[model samples]
Target: MTNFKPGEVTTTHIHSDILNRNITLSVYLPEDYSDLYKSKVVFCFDGRDFLRFGQIHRVYERLRREKAVERVIIVGFHYESVEKRRIEFHPQGEKASQTVQAVAREIMPWIDQTFPTYKVGNARVLLGDSLAGSIALLTTLSYPRVMSQVGLLSPHYDHVVESLFQRCQFKDDLTIWHVIGKEEKDFKLPTSGERADFLTPNRTLNRLISATSATYFYEELDGGHNWKTWKKELPALLKYFLSNQ
Candidate 1:
């Protein structure tokens, strides 16, 4: 097995004209990194939350050791604040278009320049959860040639279903992995009169995937919207994506 340490974590800031602010980005490099060779890259939204809550570095290390996935570089794009995060990551407003542009023009370019990455279609994967998942789906659809693989964990779908499908057409070249909890049907939120009736929307998304020429995988796990579920699902997700490599 390939033993790995925690690896290096670095932070940088980018000036975004679209959002009229600077965004901080966190990058996690695998322990077995080599600049001489290019590695597959996974771009994830909500960098700070993922780093703290998801423990992705630890998970990546374990998966690498097990040889389930190839060596990968993780790029986490952190939003400015909670308020800004919601506005930027949410796929329901005019600002959402700006946010996507910021990622494609500013964030992705910087990472491609800084790291030795495959810089191709399928080798680059986009990932997110909740609102970020919506953004990931939007971005991948908008830029299919750049991002061919999308990982969505428990996406939040209230009423954006039609717009999502209208904007992007699924092709055979794309690969998508979507998962939600079996108990997430009509799940309620504590703070407000909000709820995630994810079962129907997810099923709809799965049906769309089925109609498309894309390779798709859908699963219903035994948990709710939490890191435990995501962590448990990460290994198999990575294996599925990396198997094509």
Candidate 2:
């Protein structure tokens, strides 16, 4: 088991000409990031909490030092407020479309121009938790050429977006790593102020993905919808998908 500690997080601002908004980006790089080595780039949503509660930077550093995962850059986009988080992370929200466009058109191009990144789609990854997980999947499906791999930690599914599952057609190139807690069936949603059945929709999603030929992995743990469970599983997902490939 890895005992991970928090590492220093650096911040930068990028102006998205498409949305006419400037987004703050928090980044973590491996210790030897200055060397002439190309590294995979990971974009994470719901970032501040992930760094605070998930300890993802430390996990990354430890994994790299132990040679358990590949060298990589972790870029996090923090939600300004809870309301903004729900608004932007919602797959049907207008902000979600803008966020996806910013990722595909502006943010990725900036990373490619500024960092020593493996620019191929297969080398890029999108990661998110809960509703942000839904954002990650929607974004990857929207721009499969830019992000081919996704890590979804308990993605929220609503009745409005069932068509996405029926429309999924990226089995040929996209890969997915997903995990949901068995206890998420009666999870309370803050945004909707209603008890949601996350597990059922996630199971439906699992079945849908299984029907496709995409490389996929799914795990149902005896836990709840929280960071503790995700933190525990993060290292393995990183090693399996992003290491040595």
Candidate 3:
């Protein structure tokens, strides 16, 4: 943490016409960021948690110092609250579709136009965990061309998700990295107090994505659904994203 050359971190609030709200974003540009060439842009949801609970920033800095993966830009989408996260990221949320569109139509374009990037979907990554992961998957499905690269960590599943996969078409150029905990078979919902089988649906989703022509990787580990479990997987996930491209 001390020896690595730290990246520049900046925060901003951008007004989105689609969501009709000021969306908060934080960007991490590696020490090697250059204007002469493009860099892969990783757009992460659950911005605040990934930095705090997930320790992605620390992990990323270490990765860069080790030269494990090539330098890339990381962007985090900050949610105001848990309810706000669900309203936009949940599969059944009213604004789910709009949130997906906003990432593809609004945020990505801004990132590309403002920075030296590939200016296409393949050069971008959508990464999130749980509900945030669910929206990442839906966003990729909704706009395959603009969001071809994705990382979904234990995506919270529902019939709506399964139905979307059943109805949508999968393109060949997509790359995906999805993971779930083997012990996450059943857990009590924090909000609804209902029993849910996260493992089964994640398996179903694996089969669904595996059946497509996507360049995909799926894993089931001996862990549960929490930041402790996810933080350890950050290196692998980021490597997977950088490896495929």
Q: TM-score of the candidate numbered 3?
A: 0.91
lDDT winner between 1 and 2, please give it: 2
Question: Can you rank all candidates by TM-score, best first?
Answer: 2, 3, 1
- CA deviation > 4 Å runs, candidate 3: 1-6, 190-194
Off by over 4 Å in 1: 1-6, 158-161, 167-170, 190-193
Model 2 / residue 217 / CA error / Å: 0.2
TM-score of each: 0.90, 0.92, 0.91
Give a tens-digit lDDT track for model 1, residues 156-227. 664564465555654666898999887778767542558867767777777777887788899988988777
Q: Candidates 1 and 3: which is better by lDDT? A: 3
Instruction: Give the distance in Å from residue 192's predicted Cα in candidate 2 to where it truly belongs.
Output: 5.8
Better of 1 and 3 by TM-score: 3
Q: What C-alpha root-mean-square deviation, in Å, does candidate 2 show against the real structure?
A: 4.4
Instruction: Please report how far candidate 3 places residue 75 from its true position, in Å.
Output: 0.4
Model 1's lDDT to the true fold? 0.78
